[model samples]
Target: MRDFNRYRHKGAFCLMKYAAEDGSEVEWIWNSRDGVTPFCVSNRTGDKMLQHVDWHLDRRIFDYQPMPCERIFVDLSPDRARQRAERTIEHYWNRDDCAHIRQLFGTKEKAIEGLLAESRVGEAPDLVEFGSLEPGAYRR
Candidate 1:
């Protein structure tokens, strides 16, 4: 089977292309730094999923964007993930309050997860819905 999923916000759209082999999932998000490692280690068996809804504006990058609160998630390759790690390090270097954990992961998913943890200021939004992949790509 063929499937496509998209997460659309005010200014961003994150799309996922998965075959039936990849499973059926609606959202992907990690709620806590402590849970991230376990979730990853466990391959999402009990991990929290991102809820489908309009994400809040990202105040930091919003000025540059027509919509300020959109969060975009793109699938990452090894190289891109490494590049993201480097970029995240640069972005946080001047901020003493930054978390060292962002750069700990070897992959972009991990690093991005770290970024989300560090940048989050409020509770996770309520206008969202999360569902496990029908078949799922991974098993814990």
Candidate 2:
């Protein structure tokens, strides 16, 4: 197994390759802001498997644990991840009857911070969450 510590940095970009038991190549890209996306290249002719795979950062182990599989290679880089994170926009929403959007943030951490600040001032409720969207999406 590759050392996951080197890849678990904030805003890091990690590209991991895997070989499935059925002789297929899988590529998984992990971005802190964008989350994980998996691409599968089938070796058998006319057999294609493309689907969304759920993965999460395991805080206890301080590593990302995907569905049980062996990883072939891991490439960790921060430059492109940081650049993309800067361009992405996030929405901070208060969990209430209407789920009102409070404000826009550049990152999830910023949205959490904003929510915490508002909660401290009694301006926002305790149930707050954030979601990412494209730039200028809120204007439409």
Candidate 3:
């Protein structure tokens, strides 16, 4: 039995919701970024069973090949994960304008970068929790 873990792919991978042709909303775990188009995208379970065929010299060749399903899973290494963490932090940091937090990083991107460097992927010290801003400031 092969343990084929799709989440543990070679590049950045995330569980994304995709709308299928049948009007059914299915959860598909893909690694492709927003703008880039993939050659082919499959479900998290990269299983391809007899979906194509080919004809050879006096013989028919059936293709049960595993199609390349959006080879976008960023190599899930510690370094790569750390890089992703930095990117995530930078994204949030750029959009965040709480005034109080801005004082901590006055005209200094390095301050934010250093803070992110000290943290791990998906885990960061909440600026709000640090009493940098008031609660109920923004609601979705």
- In order, the Cα lDDT scores of the candidates are 0.32, 0.33, 0.34
Q: Write the per-residue lDDT of candidate 2 for residues 1-140, one digit (tens) a residue.
A: 64445543432333333345444544453332222323443332336653323334322233443333322112222332333333432322434542333335544667555544433231111111112322321110
Q: Model 3 misses residue 37 by how many Å?
A: 24
As for model 2, its CA RMSD to the true structure in angstroms is: 15.3
lDDT of 1 by residue, 26-115 (tens): 433322111111111112334534333333421222112212222222222333444455687667654557545444565556666665
Global lDDT of model 3: 0.34
Q: Distance from true position, residue 40, model 1, in Å?
A: 19
Q: Which scores better on TM-score, 1 or 3?
A: 3
Off by over 4 Å in 1: 1-51, 54-75, 99-140
Candidate 3 local lDDT, 1-140, one digit each (tens): 42224323232223333434454334333332112223234434544211111112111112112123322222133444456556655566555565444567664365556555665433221111112223332111
- What TM-score against the true fold does each predicted structure earn? 0.22, 0.19, 0.27
Output the TM-score of candidate 3.
0.27
Number of the predicted model whose lDDT against the real structure is largest: 3
